[model samples]
Target: MSGSFSLFIVGWGIIMIVLLAIGGFFMFRKFLKRLPKEDGKSILDWEEHYLELTRHMWGEDEKQFLEELVSPVPELFRDIARQKIASKIGEVALNKKQKQITRDTIIEGYIIATPKRDHKFLIKTLKEKNIDLRPYQSLFEQA
Candidate 1:
């Protein structure tokens, strides 16, 4: 009876260890999934939801709109738009070496396409998609 009881203890220890290992493995996998890729570029999880709204908003003109939306006034406001966008990009970026210059620059320039009073429309649209307009405000006087 003593030997059989000792064996049962050993078996229970093995079972507990296996259970802990399985739990640890799943936890580790979950952690790894949140980790960025080796290239330091990762698809943000919120992008899909944001993009869905943009798709609905832009419809067939998504690419064209994003393209022509920037500096739409051409030769007249081109330099003003460029300078304002660069200024806004500087504000949003933490440091000079920041890689986030392009996006906010474009958003700022897009704002230039609209009248100051109508800027709220674009801001509201972006806000609905969970996009923050604070970082993208350049053409406004207070930005």
Candidate 2:
């Protein structure tokens, strides 16, 4: 009876260990799956690509739009200004007059326009300000 009881206890312990090991393996696999897949690209590279893509798609007007949306405090305004300028240049239209007007309106809208409730207002304001938007330019350009 003592021998049988010891064998039973040993078998139960082994079973428990096996079950725990299986559970741990599954948990580890799940954790790996939750982690972001690395394409061997550095974060800075990804950021540059994202910025370039955004610049290609939205241009300067979008930068100004982001500034208005964020309303950086005085300390951060210079960085915002640089971004605004860069984005503007990135999206400048072919017609100089139209581009200037669009730039001016974006600035004016940021300063004077009421807090917009919808994103469409930004696009509408750009159009109303007579800015020509070429959204597809980035897609067509060869990287």
Candidate 3:
């Protein structure tokens, strides 16, 4: 009877261990599936690489164009623009506008078109209304 009881105890221990192992295996797989996969390249990284290639192909004009468009905005605004570009919102409008605005003209236009510092006032008004301008930075940058 003693030997039989010991055999039953050992068998139960073995069964519990197997069940635990199976549960752990499934849990590990589920965890892995739920985790986000990384291709390693981020949107910014891709954009930089693409811009570098464009600069190479199109020469200084393309680089200057990108610099003029991208350099005016604050870093935070630039990041928002990047995300908006990824979303493809009003892409055609921006493409059309880019052709019209020369780099020299943009600086001059901003100075001439906005008087009484109205642009600052408008920004303040928008902020007061809780409007998020970050998303719209790309639209302005293209102008």
Candidate number of the best TM-score: 1
State how far residue 27 of model 1 sits from its true place (Å). Answer: 0.8
Cα lDDT of model 3 by residue, 1-143, tens digit = 99999999999999999999999997786566445448766544544444443322333553354344444457855654433332221222234444333433323333222334445754564455465667556445454
Between prediction 1 and prediction 2, the one with superior TM-score is 1
Write one digit per residue (lDDT tens) for candidate 2, span 1-143: 99999999999999999999999997786565445547865433443443464444445656556455444335634464344433443333322334333444344433332223433554464456565546523322321
Each candidate's clash count: 0, 2, 0
Cα-based TM-score, every candidate: 0.30, 0.27, 0.27
Cα deviation at 38, candidate 2, in Å, is 2.8
- Residue runs of model 2 more than 4 Å from their true location after superposition: 39-143
Alpha-carbon shift of residue 100 in model 1 (angstroms): 30
Q: Give the TM-score of candidate 3.
A: 0.27
Residue 118 shift from truth in candidate 3, angstroms? 67
| Candidates, ranked, lDDT | 1, 2, 3
Clashing pairs in 3: none
- Taking all chains together, the TM-score of candidate 1 against the true structure is 0.30
